[model samples]
Target: MSGATSTGDVLTINGTGLFVDDRGPKDAPTLLFVHGGPGQGSYDFMHAQGDRLAERLRVVGVDQRGVLRSDPLPSGAPLNVQVLLEDFEALRQALDVDSWTILGHSAGGGYAIRYAHQHPASVRAAIYDCPCWDSDGTDRYRLPIAADLLERYGELEAARRCRELAAKPERLDPDDQSWGAMRALGKRYNELFFHQPDNTDALDRIGSQSGLTEDQWRRGVSHLPLLTEMYESKQHLLPELSQPSLLVHGRHDLVVPPDDVQAFRDSVPNGRVHTFERSGHFAYIEEPDEYAAVVTDFVVSAHR
Candidate 1:
C-alpha cells in the first residue's frame, strides 16, 4: 500500500450544484475519475486510488450530484440519468481541460460509458472497470453475485425479494425498513465479492457516504433503488463511444462477472479487455500491482 501525499482542491460545478476533488498536477494529462452512485461522491474511495494514480497522471475525482460534498441530492432533484450525463459535460468545460481520459468503477462504470458516448471528441481514452452495462444485463450478470449473498445469509425469503427487485426495476420507497435491510445485505455481499483484506473499513466508508447517519442511511436505503434500473439500462449506449477503451475485470468477479466483461469487449468498436486471474470485483484493491500495470499500459499505449 502507498502512503497518501495530498495536494488537491475542491471546486463546485457552477449551476449544477455538484463538487469535484481535483488532484495531481495541472500540467499533467488529466485523467478524470467519474465515481458511481448517481448520488454517491468519489471522496474517500477515489482518494485512496487517486493517491496512487495521481503520481503518474493528474487524477481528477468527482463527487457526482447528491453524494458527499456535492449539492442537490437526488432527493432534491428529478433523479434522471440524462441530467447526470449533462452535469459531466458541464464539469469538463468548467475544468478547462482540452482532452482527457476517464476511468469508472462499478456504478461509476455506467456513468463513464454514458459520458464517453456523449462526449467522445473530448475523451482521449476511456476505461470501464466492471461497468454496469444494462439494467436487464445486470440482472442476468449479477445472479451469481446474488447467489453469493444468499449463500452467506441463507435467507431464502430475503434472497427471493432481492431477486425480484433486481429482476423488475422499480423505485423503492426510501423510508422502508425492509429496503434498508436489503441494501445492507447487498453491501455486505459486495464486500464478500471483492474478498479484500480490509473490506469492512471500505464498506463502512461506502455506507457512510450517503450523507446520512446510520439510522437514516439504513432507513433511506431504498433511495438508490434506481441503481438497478440504471444498471440494467447500461448497454444500449455502448455504440456511441468511439474512444479507445479498456475494460478490466476479474474473472472471478462475483459482482459484475466475467461474462459481462466479455460482452463489453464484443460491443465496443475500439475496446480491449484485461482479465485478472484470482481477483474478484474490486480488482484494483485485490490485485493492485496488476491493476496499476493494466491502466498504465493502456494509457501509455494510447498516448503513443
Candidate 2:
C-alpha cells in the first residue's frame, strides 16, 4: 500500500497475513484480483488499473498468502491447488462479502478457474485476461509462441537463451539465477503484452512504483514450488466451473494462445472469449479502455 492511492489493509486469515488494497465505493460490485506469477504480488495491477476500474466496481487487489506485503509462508508450508482455493475462501469470508467476481490474469487464471469450480456459490462471475488454462497448454503452446516472438523482434540472443532453457527437460529450481534470468528474458520479449516496444517499461515500472521491496520480490519468487505443483497436477476443469465467465486474450499472446481461449469457451457452460486483436499476454495493460469496457459490460450483464 506504500504507493497506492486506495485504502489498504492486512487481514490475518488462517495464521497468514494477506495484504489487500480496496478501492471504489464500498457498495459497488466487488472484484477480487488474482495476479499471475505464482509469486508476483498484486501491487502491479493495483498500481496500473486499480483506480481506473474502481470508478465502476470496487477493486480489491491482493498479495496472495505469501507475496509482497503479506507474511511469508513457512519454508515447508503446505502448498497446493486446494490450499490456494481455501485461502481465497478465507479472504472472502473475512471480508464479510457474500460473493464477488474474480478477475484473474495470466497464471492466476488457473486459480480463478479452480476456485469457481470448487466454490461456485461464492463467485458471481470470472474474468480471465490472457489466462494460462493449464501447464500442459503453456508448455505446448505458449512457450513456442514466446520464443518465436522474441526471434521476430530481433532479440535473437534472448530467443536463443529461451530456447536453450526450454530444451532442458529438468525443472530449474526457483532459487536458481538461471530461472530468474529466463523469466526476465521472457518478459522482455513478450510483445503481445504491449502495443509498442517502449511500453514494455510499464511492466517493471508498475512493480517499482508499487514500492515492492527487494526482499518481498525474492520471497514471492520463492513460491516457485507451488507453481511447479500446479503445472504437474494441472487439470482441464473448465467445464466444471458453473459461474458466468469471460475469457479475454490477446490474439498475439505468447503466454496464452487463442486456441486455448477457444477451448475454454467450448468447455465452460457459461463462458465467452474476447480477442484483443493487437495485444498479447497482458491485454488489460495493452488495451485498458477497451478491456475495462468489456469487463464492465460482462459483469453487469451477468448480474442482471
Candidate 3:
C-alpha cells in the first residue's frame, strides 16, 4: 500500500523531536493536517487523501506530540493547551513555512483553533471538521446527540463509563481500566461517528503500522479528560482566531453534534460550515471526495 511506504520524517522542536510525513509538491501551498487523538498519529486515512488534495496544493500530515512516530514528549511538559500551541509554532518554524493552512479533525480541531488564535500570523486558513469544542471540559457536547445512539446501540454502558471517567479527571492515566475504556470508546466511536462502521479497523491498522504499543494508546486516551477542556472552549478561542476558516460536521455525528458545529459557525467572524448528511465523526474518511474538494477549494481561495 502507498500508505506503508510513507515514512514520517523527523524535525526537532525545542531541542526535542517530532515527526511528520509529507506528500504533494514542495511548491504547492502547504496544508498542515492535524490528526485527531492526543494519541492517534497521522495515519493512512489522512494519507489516502493526499493525491486528491495534492492535485491542488501541498499537504503535510503531522503526528503531534506524544503520538506514534513523533518524539516522546518531554518528561515534565504539561500536555496542556499551552504546550501544544508552542509545539505547533515550533513545527512551523522547523518546516520554514512562512504561512500555511490547517485542517483539523476531532480533537485536532481544538489544537488548530488554539494555534490559530495564538499565531494568527502563520495561518492562511483553517478547516474544523466535527469539532468537539464546548464551554466546559465535559462530554456534554457529545451527550445530547449521542444519547439515543448510546441507549439504542447498547453503548449506554460505555457512554456512562466515559462520563464517569470524565467526572473523575484524576483517573486519566495509564491503567488497565483506562486502556479498556479507550478500546471500548474506539469501537463505539467508529460505529457512532463514521459513515462506515468498519473504519474502526483503520485505527487498529494505524496503531500497528505506527508501532504504538497498547500502553501508549491507553496513556494517550487517559489524557482526554484533561484535553477535553480545550475541546469544549470554542467561543473564547474561536473569536480570538483571525484566520479564514471552514467548519464542517456530519449532521449525523452524535460525537460532536452538528448543532454545536453550527453554533460555532455562526459565531466565527470569518467562517463557514458544511454538513455531511451521511457522515458522523470521520467525515473525511467517510466522504473523502467531497471533504477534500471543499477543503482544497476553500484553502486555495483563502490563500493570499
Candidate 4:
C-alpha cells in the first residue's frame, strides 16, 4: 500500500518519472487533474481542492511531464500535444485505471478535449474549469480587458502594446504574438486573473507550497517554446465533443473570455456551461465552496 495510496508517488511512464498524488478511496470514481501553463504542475489545484474533492472522488493530480513534480523533457526532444496525450495514456495504464474523469483548467482544457476525443472509452466525463479552449479566443477577448487594466495601473506602454496585438487579424501566425509586450505587462498581468484585483493570495499560497526541488520549480521555462502547439490544437475540437461535458467559466474572467466559454458550450453535442459569477480565472480559489459543490456535483451526476 506504500505507493498505492501515498499522496506523493512517482510513476515512471515512458522512461520519465511523473509525479502523481493519488488520494481517496481506490474504488471511488477517479478524477485526474490536467494542469495548464503548458508545463505547470498540478500542485495548485491539489493544494486548493484536493482534500475537498477526494472525499467523494479519487483525486489524482499528476504534474505534466517536464513540469513541477514530473521529470523534465530531455534537451532537443520535442514536447507537443501528442507526446502529452501518450504520457497520460501510459500513466493511466500504469495506475491500472480503466478510465477517469478529467478536470482540465485554463490551457489544460485543450488537452482534456483532445484526450476525450482520442480516448472516448477512457474518459467517463470531463470538467473544463475556466478553460482556454482557443488561444485566438483568449487573446481576442482577454487582451482588451488586459489593456484597460494595464492603462488603469499606469502601464501605458504595455497597454498600448496589448491594444495593438489585440487588433491584429484573428488568425495571424502564432509567431506574430508579441510575448515581449505581454512580459512587459509585468505585475499588472496578475490582475487579469481575478474578479477582485487584490484577491490573489492563492497564487502565493500555491506557488510557495513545499516539496519541489529548485530545478522542478523552473520546468515551465523550458516549455515556453512548445505552447504554440497547445494553442493550435485546442482551436479545432469543440465542435466534435460528444460526451457529457461541464464548461465552468468565471464571469469576470479576463484570462479567457466568458462569451467564448459559452460559444464552446453551444458547439458541443452535450456540453453545459456553469458561470462563476464572482470568480475570475481561478474559480476554485476565488469561490472555493461553490467551486467544490459544482465540480463534485458534476462528477457525481454527469454520467448518470
lDDT of 1: 0.64
- Evaluation by TM-score, superior candidate among 3 and 4: 4
Candidate 2 positional error at 117, Å? 0.5
lDDT of 3 at 44: 54
C-alpha TM-score for every candidate: 0.78, 0.85, 0.80, 0.92
- Which parts of model 2 have CA positions greater than 4 angstroms off? 1-7, 149-187, 190-195, 232-235
lDDT of 3 by residue, 101-128 (tens): 9888777787788878778899989988
Ranking by TM-score: 4, 2, 3, 1
lDDT of 4 by residue, 74-174 (tens): 89877787888898888888889888889999878878888999998889899887776677667767777777877877889888877888898666346
Per residue, candidate 2 scores C-alpha lDDT tens digits across 1-304 of: 1333335887777788788888888777888999878778887777767887888887888888878888888888877767778888998898778889998887888788888878889999999887766554465454555567667767777566656656667654333233333354555644545665766777777767656578888778666766665454234687777888888877777667556766776788888888888676776777778877888778767666
List residue ranges in candidate 4 displaced over 4 A.
1-6, 233-235
User: Highest lDDT among the candidates is held by which one?
Assistant: 4
Ranking by lDDT: 4, 2, 3, 1
lDDT of candidate 4 vs native? 0.78
Clash count per candidate: 11, 1, 3, 0
**How well is each residue in 21-83 modelled by candidate 1, as lDDT tens digits?**
666677776787876544545665453566667667777876666555454454445655566
Q: What are the lDDT figures for the candidates, one per model?
A: 0.64, 0.73, 0.68, 0.78
Model 3 stretches astray by more than 4 angstroms: 1-6, 135-138, 144-189, 198-200, 205-225
Return the TM-score for candidate 1, rounded to 2 decimals.
0.78
